[model samples]
Target: MPEQKAADATPRRLPPGGGHRGGGWMNAGMPAERSMNFGPSARRLLGRLRPQRLHLVAVITLAVVSVALSVIGPKILGHATDIIFTGVIGRQLPAGSTAEQAVEGARAAGNDNFADMLARMDVVPGTGIDVAALARVLLLALALFLVASLLLWWQGWLLTGVVQRTVRRLRADVEDKINRLPLPYFDRQPRGELLSRVTNDIDNISQTLQQTLSQLLTSLLTVLGVVVMMFVISPLLAWVALVAVPLSVVVTQQIAKRSQRQFIAQWTHTGELNAQIEEAFTGHELVKVFGRQREVEAAFHAKNEELFRASYGAQFISGIIMPAMMFIGNLSYVVIAVVGGLRVASGTMSLGDVQAFIQYSRQFTQPLTQVAAMANLLQSGVASAERVFAVLDADEQTPDPAEPARVTRPRGRVAFEHVSFRYAPDTPLIEDLSLVAEPGHTVAIVGPTGAGKTTLVNLIMRFYELDAGRITLDGVDVTTLRRDDLRGRVGMVLQDTWLFNGTIRENIAYGRPDATEEEIMAATRATFVDRFVRSLPDGYDTVIDAEGSNVSAGEKQLITIARAFLAEPSLLILDEATSSVDTRTEVLLQRAMAALRSDRTSFVIAHRLSTIRDADLILMMEQGRIVEQGSHRDLLAARGAYHRLYQAQFSQPVADDATLEPASVAT
Candidate 1:
């Protein structure tokens, strides 16, 4: 019925230990941690990059070219070292001595092992260091490195654009999806939880892509290139260096497996904590009025503690990956160093070849280490992605008709034919009830809480689809008509007044954006908003805060009424529209509404029976059925359900000839 009034009239308290489920107060639609599907979620996240495939390909190409250049530099430096070593050995021998003479001289001098080492070297006894060749090789290596660095920079630039564009598209999709979702979807989801998905989770996804995409690509390619180069120099050393690969894999898999659950839990707790904070702040005054500040603080602390535990566990477990990988890499390095040194001493492998192989071994392990380090970010990103994807994948409201019916001249003749609806399968809120509001009639629905008053108006607006019968507006089924078209013809003023962060003038003109200043002022005067506006320093330009806390509740209600008046719609729905206003202001509002409702059908759902006494038709509802329907006078004369309600409400007997006027009721 009057949803806001019903909710505010009765508040439900959480039972003791109620919110500790799954380690936090889980939202209705939130998936359980154990149910998270990492693989499918990750794949779907990757699919968002499909639109940026061309840019990704270019990034991959740049990475490959740059890494190839980087991998070849070490071998070139080794060759330069060989040239210097040869020249240094030549300088130690006698001038003009031949290579054979040097070896024999070394053997004759009781250095036979040295002679053997010299035999393997391309040393000239008479020559000095080849400075020219060394310079050329070093310069070549420098040039290659410089080019590789430039390519990497360009790749990073391209990758950044790709990531930002992808995130932008994702944000647009989420916005569109929210607009398409049914009202019940929001009823199930907490505002803060949804905000977390839209803002925080999306931001996390962006950061993860920026950090991991380029680095992961370069690391993978570097590993491959380095492995090939290592084999080219010495297959034996290559095999020895690869001994760490399997071990690194094991460590990463084990840590990631454990850390992934923690990451999911961390984000889940984050959302829950956000919801609690939003609720506490929004209702801070109420909490104080009820002396529940301590309880609120206690709930906040519990949620915050859950978040801390989840975050600490995730970080602690994932942090072990890098150190473990480094240890494995170091072990491989030691083995490669000893084997390469032994090969060099035996003269089977040149010193330069061993040097190049050692460099290659380090290069191979470095990328492996980088990959291990990124495991934490990858896991966290996937967890956030799953949350976002869940929203994207939720069931949307039924689509509007393909060929919508139009009311060229709407007379606001709304009729419900055997309409039935239920929020749940077992609990019927409205059933097989029918009613009609003729053109230019003011229909007032009066009832206690949960009497289907607001629900009837909601049905005419097509907020919820009927389970059986259909509602028609001007002989056209509301479902067949486009929602925008139907709503455009109707103006609504809810008990809960909503004003955006804007000027008073702007808020009043929200429904009629193209209305002139003269028209806006007229509306404000009609609804008594102009009376207060003239007293404010800024007058019509006075700004309202996001929560409209800057204005009094009565003034806020007046502004909303003025907004509805400005629309000049074919039909009007006022659900406790004057509930917030004082008696004087409400009397003024009644006059304004009388003027606005002229020649237009109006539906007014009110608990204050005095406001609707003059309504042409009054429907008294109870338990989803209309117990009585007639003019206020006729219903009182019958002394039935409506008479009993009136007597109970006023708590007094009234003379049959006396009229119950607004002014008298206010007194």
Candidate 2:
């Protein structure tokens, strides 16, 4: 269903109070406090690339050559300029005289090699113009340019595959980590924020690998190569250019340091914004019903504004690198020009040599400016990588015991022996709780909100480890069994129905992927889902949208019931499974549940007293302990909490075997 249409179609009968206001979206995946170690995080990130060491070496080699060509091209062009200058100056000599005569006349006392002496002569045909030599030099420069371009392309092509493979492995590791995480981890995190880590943060790392890595390498290489070339041309001009290097470094470091916090803040705020949007849209029904549209909008606007401020601050601070470096570079250039002009006038350095030194000086400063500009980008990429690594570094759930036991065909006898648990260390919710349910018995757990009804079920399923004692299933300690084996034998139909985007048949058969079509049809028919399935045009093939929004809440609940039924587990848990259905559907559902629970051990957590009045054992809980426990008649005779609860829910004592049905009660 389109989001707009679904938002507009509010349920005709919303529960008296809105259902859970804080849902999957309310939790931001990231922590509020920001802390990171840039050096360690960068090292760890680079370590992931170790598998691509060969590819990295090749890329670095190519980058060095590319930068070397760029540095050499300018010096060669300067040589051409020198040749033209000498040709013009030599015009004062005889028409065919070359600069070789002047070099020979000014020969030093040291012996010169034959090749060196030959190179001193201009090989061009004319004395005033070396057209052929200039053309040859230009042609060499063009060839270098073309070769560098090809090397750059080849480097990029190789690195792209390597980077993609690395990211792919990282993404897979993250996915595996998520699966191994304890339920409490998810409880403490926001769904959207976690999603941001998996997507936004990882994507940022990919982009940095694709673009920034090559550029950064090339820039650093260019800077080093240019510095060396500058010194060769004229150490005086080289020193002048080096003066700007430290200044640029100081400027870049200062600005980047200031921008780091903003970059972290920007990403953090982005996570908050994504979480808010996810929550608002997921619970749009509650917002519309309670007229909380303005409140949601205001909350979103606040987060968006915070993100905007952080993003702007990060950009503005990092942006200072380029212009500041350029200004310093330009100042150094002017200094070199003044010094080199005096040397040329005094004939200590020829005009051609001075011109070549100027070219080398420009090349020296260009890469410094580029490096400054890239500092911010590299910092941001590191921040993103740090977040991705955090997920990989998270503590995982305890592994199953060595030589774990497997339940072949569970008899469903469960015993909670002196079990103690609490969500937090300071707040004890369940203490020394003991309970037993034999095979084929119905154990009804009824309690007020926060009275540990769901906690009891969670313990039985081993979704959490007990603080002090053991929970046993069929006389086997649950802790000794693999979690997958333990949960596989226990089926649950929760209050909140969850159905992914798929055909109705797929949703119903989720619990047993290899279930035959006949079994699926039979389970759906038993749960009364077949009645509604036939009404739809596509029947079992109809697609259910995300959250099963295309279907009504009651329909969604029934489908989940069918899923549990199809699994045919030895133990069944219905945690307000009938809460969403209408009174009529609930009655039929109860009948179906009765048949489904006939031979299996069942735990029913509900607020409606009528539904559980006939349970084999009823546990009326207050806080974390069971205050009352007995058969319905025995409990009423005691006139205790269960009796009081039953009296409050009905007009009179319910003695009828079949006529004591009541609607869903808010817990």
Instruction: List all candidate RMSDs to the true structure.
Output: 4.5, 6.9
TM-scores of all predicted structures = 0.93, 0.88
- Worst 10-residue lDDT window for candidate 2 reads 1-10
- Top lDDT prediction, candidate number: 1
The runs of at least 3 residues in candidate 2 whose Cα sits more than 4 Å from the true structure, single-residue gaps closed, are 1-32, 96-126, 348-356, 652-666
Candidate 2 per-residue C-alpha lDDT over 573-596 given as tens digits, one digit per residue, 9 for 90 to 100: 988899899999899989999999
- Cα displacement (Å) at residue 359, model 1: 2.5
Model 2 lDDT on a 0 to 1 scale: 0.79
**Tens digit per residue, CA lDDT, model 1, 1-667:** 2334333222223222222222223332234355367788888898999999999999999999999999999999999888988898888888888899899998899987678778889898878889999999999999999999999999999999999999999999999999888865665566677788899999999999999988889999999999898888888888888888998998899999999999988888787777777777877898899998887788787777778888999999999999999999889988988998887776677788888887888888888888888888888999999888878999998899999889877899999899888756667778888889998999999866767787778778777678989998999989998889999999999988889999999999998899999999888888888998999999999999999999999899999999999999999999889999899878878988998898899999887889999899999877677778999999999987677667656866556624543322332
Which structure among the candidates has the greatest TM-score?
Answer: 1
Which residue pairs of candidate 2 clash?
A: 27-190
lDDT of 2 at 552: 95
